[model samples]
Target: MASADDVQRLFLQALVSRRVVTKSLARILLKKCVEAVKAAKEDLDIRIPDNDDSVNTFVINLNASLDKLDLEIVPFVDGLTGNQVYVLANRKGDEVAQVASDYSPAELAYFKVLAEMIITAPNSSYCLSSMAALRETQSLKATFTKTHGERVLDTFVARGWLYKSKSGRYSLTTRSTVELQTYITNTFPNDILHCTVCHEMVFRGIRCYTRNCEGVLHNHCYAAYKRARQTCPVCDTPWNGDSEGKLKKVGEGAFVEGQDKHARARRRVDDEDEDEDETPKQEEAPSRLRHRRRGRGKLRPKGR
Candidate 1:
């Protein structure tokens, strides 16, 4: 049997290499690590059991060691898919500290600007069209060119910081939401929106139609919310739009797709694609701590 420490080290290595992984993937990866350790060490002390509780125990011990290094494994329910994910987070430091060492100053600056734009997007789209994002470099004082912008976005998507949808829109991935949660909340306290059902920060989701009520709900949560009642949970206003919350797009009547099987499948595939790069060679720049002063228009849902 492998020692508990050995199992923990093996599991931590896998997590650090991937940076982010689904809970299901973590379970499978952990099983492999334990088996490898058992094959290598014959007389190790401490027998680690193969069970769900064992994973919790491993995380507790690993976090104790990670504390001294200002790093810890964080688990959060993905807002889009509702599947839990784990991320290696930097505690009490810049959210992008780990990746900052590899990127240049201009790259970092462009990332900061782009991130703010996505977060503050009108109607809480929480996404930017690929074309708009590519052209963003022209507005920056930094020496980032359009080609650099393309590469940076692609790299960030590959690294699990961003997700590129089928429509070529870019939005923050669950990894970014978990890692940047504190930063986003603090920097955009008033601008940030939360789901009325789960009460957690929501980037893309449904919204209620009451004129002054700022009620929003994740697509997954909205389904259950609809089954329970046909009114706004916050203001008790009668639900006006379809269950999908098809609000008017910023420039058109485009509707963001709900969390369907296709969306979940795409997210799973994105995670699998990250397997090629065990360790991220480059990452986004440091997130600026200051609040962005910008105007945002409210999204008005069309009545059915």
Candidate 2:
């Protein structure tokens, strides 16, 4: 019969192989690992329950085992989609630059700038348009052309470091949040905003409409908040749930009225090009849209 330690070792190896995985995927992997371990020896007598609780037990034990090595399995809900994700994260150090070990120095420099721009984007849009991203390449000291920059950005998307919207705007993926959380919070302390309801870091969410009110909530959190009270948690101002395009600068610690520039530009471009397939037929109307935007189109991050 395979011991519990055998199963834990197999699960840890799987997590190390895939640094980030959806909770559902992780659960499936856990089952597979148990099966593989059981097959390693004659395990017909000892039957381990193949249920969700098994994962919880495995995670707790594995984390304790990994504590000395400064590695842990971190679980977080995706701010945009609310899906649970598990990350094999390093618990020590703030060397986010070393996360993408495959990239060269020049590529790493480009990635840092691109990520910073997306993190500190104005109006809390937390997005970088394709044009704006490409333009940033010219300002980099490492000498990247628009073509090279575009390719690098594509690679980032492919490697799961960034999410590229159909509209051509780019934002950090949950993987980036998991791996770079420390660097992001430390470097952009003033830019980071936590949910007023859940208190988790919010990349995109609703903000209180009242000027000088610093309340912010994730979309899911806002839905729950609105059901009980139609007011901002921080300032007690009325909220009508139509607070879109009202995010203010993070430094001001307030809410201001304005639409996202990228969204506006995307609208303008769509209007100008009627034949464009910016919004595919498969997409829902903006009113019914969820996490991802139905808007139109950024920069080059290197060698993700």
Candidate 3:
């Protein structure tokens, strides 16, 4: 464990040695790096986190380190989103760039508005109907037509910003969710707060449509609740089942290479979880086989 700490501790060191350190967790870890730097106080050459034990622990891609002139890393916590986002800030303390320089003004505006609408909409986490997104997008401005909005949304899905279902429902990818979290939380505080049914931060949920019921419940949780109680678990309001069949699941298409980066990342995290389970199962499988072989050997002796 201590040897592992040597590598992880170096990763902690590299993060702080940058322009600036942000995020509470990162800030706490920065102290260790500051101490290390002060002790060394000679030369520091940033290398990949997996280089060696003295500087190795977790693997951080060396390519991710961008070369920007006179820039510093700033940890930004937007007070609303519970996550920290790092930005390369200049002397003025403003973000150096908004990511790729190729995005047109129209594209940037369209992306933000669409992200806000999808994440802030009621029943968002369960899945916002694509039709609903179009309606909201059209309302962004007089000139923004539903057709244009649809194209923008399609572009977002293709670029891995959102997940589009075959049946035309949309869900936020982890990228969009993290980026637009502050907007979603601030815009729809009541909806995004603890689910009324389970008191959890599950915004992809359905609402109690019973005339001012205002109760929000997770889709799966509501499924069980509706089966047993036929009423809102948060409030005693009668449940309004999916009268319009909007909750029906639409099978999503398989992901392909060079598309849906967020999907790829999500699948990776899920794969990691499965791999953890497989390790124990693999050991158990071999042990079972060995036990069976021993039993056969005993049977052979009895035959003799």
Most lDDT-accurate candidate:
2
Which of candidates 1 and 3 is the stronger one according to TM-score? 1
Descending-lDDT candidate ranking: 2, 1, 3
For every model in order, what is the number of clashing pairs? 0, 6, 7
Better of 1 and 3 by lDDT: 1
- Which ten residues in a row are the worst by lDDT in model 1? 295-304
lDDT of each: 0.65, 0.68, 0.44
**Candidate 3 wrongly placed segments (more than 4 Å):** 1-94, 100-102, 119-155, 188-194, 197-203, 223-231, 237-304
State the lDDT of candidate 2 residue by residue for 178-221, as single tens digits.
76777777666676889888887788677776877789888778
How good is model 1 by TM-score? 0.74
> How far does residue 95 in candidate 2 sit from its true spot (Å)?
7.0
Candidate 1 segments exceeding 4 Å error: 1-3, 43-51, 92-100, 227-230, 238-304
TM-score of 3: 0.37
lDDT of 1 at 73: 90
Tens-digit lDDT string for candidate 1 (55-126): 667677789999987778987777667677788865545434534446666665666655666676556677
